[model samples]
Target chain A: MACGRPKLRVGPSQREGGFTDSVPATVSRMENQSMRITALIVCLPLCAFGAATAQGLLLQRAGSQAENRPVIPKASKGDQCVADTEIMRKDHMSLLNHQRDETVIEGIRSEPYSLVSCVNCHAQTDTSGQAIRIDAEGQFCESCHSYAAVKIDCFTCHAAKPAAMEVIGNAEPHLMRDNPHTLVSYLLNKEANE
Target chain B: MSRVPVADNEKSLQARRRFLQGLGLAGMASMSYSLLEVKAKTPASSDKRWGLLIETEKCSSGCDACVRGCNEEHGIDDAGDDLTRAQWIRKIDLKDELTGNETSLPVMCQHCESAPCVDVCPTGASFKRADGVVLVNKHTCIGCRYCMMACPYKARSFIHETLTEQKPSAPRGKGTVESCTLCVHRIDEEQDRQPACAVKCTEEAHSAITFGDLNDPDSSISQKLNTLGGSQIRADLQLNTGVRYQGL
Candidate 1:
């Protein structure tokens, strides 16, 4: 844990405005006495109640914090995450946003930070053995996001689950340059015919 | 021509040397061709302009294979009535008034070189990829539907209802305008697959659709265009659509 330097508290004597020193000492002393008495009378019950409530909430939170921690689902494929847990927790959104632009506009799809990769590794399976969406309730992305109270708009426009295996693995025959009717073949055929 | 008379031994040696040189040249040429073929399989780049050639004359009326394939690939089911349903590709029948000649063709996003949808989008959501595939970035889409109004081909569709079970490759949602992506996901993938519509059409033996890189002069689609010629749907608009139609 990193420790922060303590901030200096500048009192009225140290302030650039020395107007407080111009007041009569007797008048200032009487005013300070009356203000202190009024504060004690007004804040006694409020501070006591506030402190009791805060203590109770803090105790409750401390006891349940471990139980309330997000239940991260086990990854389906990789033994380790693409990034450190701390780095990903803080910077995954920016990484995904940057990658999305690179892909959508520039047509550079080979980047490592793709949202599809996240879904592929994190999506969980239900009791029926069907793959559940990563953003579904109690799932990988949702469990943490709901605990943090941060609503994500990603799953709204993006898929929450990985694509079916066949969809990714099915390799159909390409019919472009390989076709016999291509320009080179067409020219060659024409020349042969001639 | 008179052959130069050299020693028999020297003549055989020269012949062997020539044979070795020819073999080396052949090997180099084959290696270069293989290298070029391997390079072509990489993801889309600015150097390539992917497009489709639709032979309308071969497209049979009432054939909805392309439409069905597109819907299935994108997981777009019947979320609403016909008027409200999102259609990425649709079959349209055309008839000439004077000659009474009938034609049928599949109409989708033209993927214009200077797309009006890209121009009209307020949020810069409707954008054309460097490889010429136009797509809607649903994350930034404000659902204004200005792209729908600006499109001359009426290709764009507005998603009105919240959607679920969208294909992982093709993510879509409510309150956004979308259109045909030309199977950009498939194009980006390292696998050897064409667009679903073109694949289905070829499987059905119609062979009416041809997807290829327009920038590659050696491509079959470019060769066909150079020889037979194709027409844009609205040529007067000067949009320079990537999708072309033959025998229109």
Candidate 2:
């Protein structure tokens, strides 16, 4: 779109080394053509990027004035004050996924519900306002076993699966980071004793 | 764009070829090796049909040794933001009927015979071995990510960035497509070296995610997958992915 000049009808002269006997007759016929098509393919995206950067500069200009103030600059995605919706969507998805991975990084809860030593899975409820049992229901451990009228064999070897550990819900002790195992030496001693 | 005469085009092509030759570049067996005229990297054929069968049940997810060890031996980056260093051996979780629980094991590129990634790639960067395995070249890849969409298992990732350090074993670059090579660099180069992932697994926990000839019944990988009733992921695609799953 940058091209406004009219096309030239004449090809380069014979003296021009870049062209010679190898030059096609069609090339002379199309001498007026600009490299618009080829350049446009690569340049359109770059122009959009430039437009975005310009918008960012404008927003930063107005926002710089306010001090200890919450600055809410009014601008659209196209105006470049913010990331385009598509980029924001991907970033948001990645962050949510990271949180999910982090919450489960400790793997599984090791202790029984009665022991507050393990905090990864089991937690306390707030209504009781004390360290209490959490109602974590996993479909794998609960649904089918109950349907078959079979008492779950899970407790024999393993405890119930953690339920929604990543979701920040209304449970109070679940929100707290208090720990039963205090010192590394104490943990080592406890492990050695067990 | 200026139109060139047929004769001129032919001259241009000849000049291009001569320029390439002068630059000390060699092309492949095919004519359109035109594109890779200077870098004839991929091997054409091996006169042998090689294949691998994976035993999923024998795999243990917590043991990252196979993943870590493979990365070390193959010179592959164990982890990275870009495809070049992304040699991820993922551990997938699934539910079970018998125990009604969470089961996990390592997963990787299936190296399908009728690979969809190869089919979809606009550029011929992703290719298959004369033997059954599939692979990709980092240099030629434009990072279009079409291969990612074509892969049924979602095994591929378009690495958008680079990492600080490079692995000496599996050399990698930035902004490309990469996946499990089944330790192809070792298989093709070294004199019969086992894949790093398989070698790293401790026998006591769950023997190495065994790989061997799929055709031979006596082969350990074959024996395990067949007898244990291991299954493949998204078999509906009928790519016949060489990799199989056990828990789910």
Candidate 3:
């Protein structure tokens, strides 16, 4: 209300110029304040943008933990995969899907991409020598599938381990052991007694 | 070596003709031997079509050796009721009304050339292998039971409950359709061994069921079919079933 100069009466700088000075000390102080306000207005958004960029980088680093990495099993026979590592990582599911159709519809059992062959090579065992099922944590198929958030329905109807080692201590060794036809001969012998 | 000099044109021409005749004879001998080898190896093809022949007259009414063998091979846990149980193979008792003639025989999947179950399957889970063995790929099965409805022999069964400790060769689980695979795992693994049912029946002295390659003219089933002539059940359907019955 007082011509926007309310601090004029209380200022020592006002005494230096008195009434003769056109540009008063109070006006200069006001200008300084306006400059500070303009600087603050310009710098605040830039500071926020910098902080946001730093936060995004931190999140990305946290997301790349070992739990999120693909769990590729160590090959028993050779160091290399059937396909290149990058190709297998990208297109394994599609390859398996195509192989399933070939095996089921066309009866082409000689393909190298069979799921049973995969299980034979990749299935691991615990310290106790018991087979780790496909759904178990840290297992080859489950670990990668869980990391990628994909549901696996293969173990529902297919064995997760090799045929020979699956029934190790069982009485019916012929069911899945090395000699697959032993059961037929056993049954034949049993029926001979009857 | 000593060489006798003769007339230039006549001797050289005679030598050339003998050399050509010798080459032709060698080629003919090799071709004839290769043809004989091919004929001899026809029975050993992996693509050979496998089938079963059942002699119904020789099958005993009460003996369940084949059924027991199949159940043991697959680890089929016995359910409380017949309707809920999983039966891969079963004994069927047939009677003719007019003649009052009765016979008992074991029955399972016929492995049709054009399977109705394969035709009606929504997921193409029911399929016939190149070797004429019909099988159900349970991974693609959605428990829709369409295959079960389309099967003429009621060979397929749906698992209503979860199963554990399954055989590695036969991984059965809940909510899928399964059926007789004709012991395909055994067939794939062993060259000389027959199916469990056939072996059991033969050892039990019934000798009613015979398993062999249908494509091989020298196979036992083919020779028997040639002499005794077999009949296919529901031949009117034109399924051309792999399993044939003698003395039906």
Candidate 4:
């Protein structure tokens, strides 16, 4: 009757009800109404799941390559403050250039676009028009990064300081690092000694 | 961890080639058909949609063709560089503290099936291309670098300042988080151009960069990964990245 005994909306008790003497009747009424509400909610999820499953199929077909892609969440605007670039030493560049033929891409956009992105925004122009890697502290990186919040250790291994105006030629040969060649090698070498 | 199996087809591929001395482009096309037919005849794995064959054993801590390949094929030309305006697919270098050894592992935007970057991009600039390469749309990018902070692989770039020569957003700009594109643009447009790193890499050294649709069982990336062992990086993140690391 009247659609499941009226809605049991929460509110301050009826000020005019003189209910000081009728508490038992009020409690019973509320319990009966609450049961109906409970029954209604239990079915919501089941219905939703059915609808979602059908929708998921269409979305999957529309976005065919959706399944195997990675799932990185969007960062809040606070991340806008994160530093956009990291400074690195010329030595690091030379060391990594095992192929030896240097200057393949001219700038960071060529081979290693990610690493080059550091240069793209961080490289500053002098009055003479020669673009130079800016001081990391005063860079656009430190700007919003200081504002957004969080710090990354990319600056530690990578040079946060300004690099030399000129790239020093590969004057010295590099020695090979002793890092693990594979995941197994890494695990075994790390656990073996311990 | 089991080792990922290798993609070995050189002998068969060579065997399928025919010597048509006077063949024209049409003949070459017919020959190519035979080459493809031979591969099609092979009993490929049935579970096609999500298999990758990464030979982690062969992955040289030294070579980074995968990282380099995506950059070149995408034509991301940000030459005058600044660290803050950085971008590219990164190759991870892990070091052994006691042994003083280092392992160079190529890594990039893993293109998670449920990507946080897409969820986090306030402007909806970060989106995946139809063919599987995940990318950030430069036009919609507001120069806000939130996507960079959200990316686990640190795969995004930003254009920082106003330059006399404002390069397009192919490589991302001065203030965006730039990572590997998986050469979606190249893969979509060019009928035959493969990813840059895979083509440039020397097979003998370490053929690390493997590109193909992992979901397509017959694809090179899928078949190799299926036969080999591959594990996603940072599995704890719950992001099913398109790219997988083998051997680990």
Candidate number with greatest TM-score: 1
Per-prediction DockQ, in order? 0.16, 0.01, 0.10, 0.01
Please give the TM-score for the first chain of candidate 2. 0.20
- Give the clash total for candidate 3: 0
Candidates' chain B TM-scores in the order shown: 0.81, 0.70, 0.80, 0.66
- Measured against the true structure, the TM-scores of the candidates, in listed sequence, are 0.72, 0.43, 0.67, 0.41
lDDT, residue A5, model 1: 91
Runs of candidate 1 with Cα error greater than 4 angstroms are A1-60, A165-194, B1-44
At residue A90, candidate 1 shows an lDDT of 91
Name the candidate, 1 or 2, with the larger TM-score value: 1
* Interface root-mean-square deviation, each candidate: 11.6, 23.6, 13.0, 17.5
Q: Please tell me which predicted candidate would have the highest DockQ against the true structure.
A: 1
**Docking quality tier of candidate 4?**
incorrect
Model 3 has an lDDT value of 0.71
Best by lDDT: 1
Candidate 4's clash total is 74
Q: Tell me the TM-score of model 2.
A: 0.43
Docking class of 1: incorrect
Question: Candidates ranked by TM-score, best first?
Answer: 1, 3, 2, 4
> Which scores better on DockQ, 3 or 4?
3
lDDT of 4 by residue, B49-118 (tens): 2212345566677666665545544544446655754456555667779988665666666776666776
Docking class of 2: incorrect
Per residue, candidate 2 scores C-alpha lDDT tens digits across B152-223 of 776775555543333222434456777877776445433344566766674345664666666567776677
Report, to 2 decimal places, the DockQ of model 4.
0.01
